[model samples]
Target: MNVELRYLRALVAVVDAETFTDAAIELGTSQAAVSRSIAALEQALGLRILQRTTRSFTPTPVGERIIAHARRVLDELALLERVAGDHGSELRVGYAWSALGRRTIALQRQWEELHPDVSLVWVQSNAPSGGLADGSADVAVRRRPLTEGRFTSTPIGAEARFAALAASDTLARRRVLRMADFAGRTIAVDRRTGTTSEELWPEESRPAGFRPVQGVDEWLTLISTGQALGMSSEATAAQNPRPGVAYRPVRDAPPIEVFLACWRDDPSPLVADFIRLARAAYLPG
Candidate 1:
């Protein structure tokens, strides 16, 4: 039950090499050490696993069965190590709403093909810093400039802004909408996670009032019921399409800048690489 893998390995080497001296040479150990390893293996298991004569080394019937089982166990343990190693090397990326939208799958696939040593995992948190503020994520895909001093960020790409409207709203009929058109409407705003603010409009043209929401679900739900109009990075339109809401281009609005955020100090080793890979992923197609 407590046998060592090295002991089992030594036994297999002796069988395959046909002699303890040969196995010792292959293993870069002295013949006495190989002999001791096989003896220790037998003693640990309370069984004689080898039939040895002066000039011949063979396996007893039980030795044959144990050897097969040892090979299987070693192979399975090697596989387990790989699975564990992959999980340890994983990078967890947090986001509030959309994770690169249309680019998400491509990013994953390309990162895998280019660097198979690490894996990426996505977690969603509705905070403006994504999950970076909490311990839920190691790095994040954020749309706004992160003001938190604990984090540093780099711009990856910019996505056009879009207005989220009730499907039945008049603006939905327009091929493209403008900031002026949203005047006089209630704005559903997620101050923590979203990039939109009344500052995007002139003081006189801002929405009538702001209805605060904690997350995208509430923002979308309120928009669906025509309770408010909202704006988000273009990725949100592609990543989350509500059944009762429509997305229209905010032609005059400034594009939302997407950023890769990480701890200002002691960031993960993978963070910079992830940022580079992400920037490349969003390159114009």
Candidate 2:
């Protein structure tokens, strides 16, 4: 109930090094401190984490699981530190897939011209939060609405949907496509970060099956193999052009709404300016 990161670190260090003396050395602390930390951890958890002998020690069954969780916690902490450390002179913007399509370069150039002292960095992440929740970015451009109350989002613009298909597929010959056209074919979908879903089509005309994928490259690869088809915003079509894949406008599918998001409690000072630029980029010129 009252576990601390230091105690968990000591337990892991002792288990990995096989001795309190080695763990202390690895942790850059005294052996007595390491031993006490482990004991405190065990007391707090009400469980013995290690099986120790006179010469060696190993993690108990439950200790292995706890240690794994501790490693993940530590890893996340390290990531947070790295992201926070770089916040001094950089404005990191995150996106799930394709950024702003043809407008990405224009936005970057404009930002550089306006604020030469601050570097405008774009980070592409596959998570639904687009790296905002993980502290990898100060702001995020997302195609879907985030329901969490800890974040605030505003609609920037919308992008038309496009169908991705293999070059050799019969549908590729069409100048445009419709949601119902691929009702009997399998579809590749990235459930976490993608804009495509069965809900895009009428229930009666849904795809025959859905193949799961993690990122844009994987979705494109699956489609290029002629194994499945995919649907995404026009931005993806413009940014990622695979030789074996063809993108056709999906005339009937609803356009995907785009939103700019940031932490509700600690938004970046540059978020307003970034949002303004993004809205301008998405506007019809």
Candidate 3:
């Protein structure tokens, strides 16, 4: 039939209240209006749904069957509304390990204050590949500039690699070191996981006899033992400079660029707000 939801709601209210006046009060309408709605609903369905006397209203056998199904439909509509509202209000943010420093955390706090309606979730990854491709995250902070055409990126900041060595190491005496200084040195490199090509020294260019370490923690241990030196981003160097470790800038090395990346198709307001905060926090005046 062509009956609308309002008609069904009116029918249920009338059946529950057992009087047109009471149903009108429940539906926020006049008694006459409620009666007209019921009459129209009956005409559309080609069945008398209610039995009415001056003192009372009662549901017919056909009306009882329809009311059961109508209640189910109304419940489903309420659930659909809630699901849509939740999906519209939530956002997932992703970042590389080096990207989640004090500054980025502060930016997240500021963004939340400004957009209280949107929920911000933080995700961390070591890979340069942004998480949007796999849907693990909605927005990402990538250390290496994104080459994937599917994502939209904004330059956040520039990062650089620094050599970390034991203070007793000979290279530690220099104010800064060049890539060539690493020649003949037993260098520790992260080879176990998330090693992007840019983070690696080309096989031909790497120091002869350099050893690859399997984990970040293992690399740190190797460096601490005074047996090997390792390279890390400036942010990581700043955070974890041990007593025996010296951090020096790596001169003549290509700079690592950081970007805020998001799916090209995501139209979430929360993502937009976070991007705005990141630009303000990282961009130079």
Highest-scoring model, lDDT: 2
How many backbone clashes does every candidate have? 0, 0, 0
- Per-candidate RMSD vs. true structure? 21.4, 10.1, 21.3
- List, residue by residue over 106-167, the lDDT tens digit for candidate 2: 99999998778889899987655676655667788899987767678889999999999999
In Å, residue 201's CA in model 2 sits off its true spot by: 1.1
- The per-residue C-alpha lDDT of model 3 at residue 19 equals 68
**How does model 1 fare in lDDT?**
0.80
Q: For candidate 2, give the lDDT of residue 115.
A: 74
Global lDDT scores for all candidate models: 0.80, 0.83, 0.68
Over the stretch 33-123, how does candidate 1's per-residue lDDT look in tens digits? 9888889999999999998899888899999999888866755554454345335868779898889998999889977886787788898
lDDT (10s digit) by residue, model 3, range 154-242: 78777677888989998889999987877677777653232223336655567656576644566777888898877767766755657
TM-score of each: 0.67, 0.73, 0.55
Candidate 1 lDDT for residue 285? 80
lDDT of 2: 0.83
Ordering by TM-score: 2, 1, 3
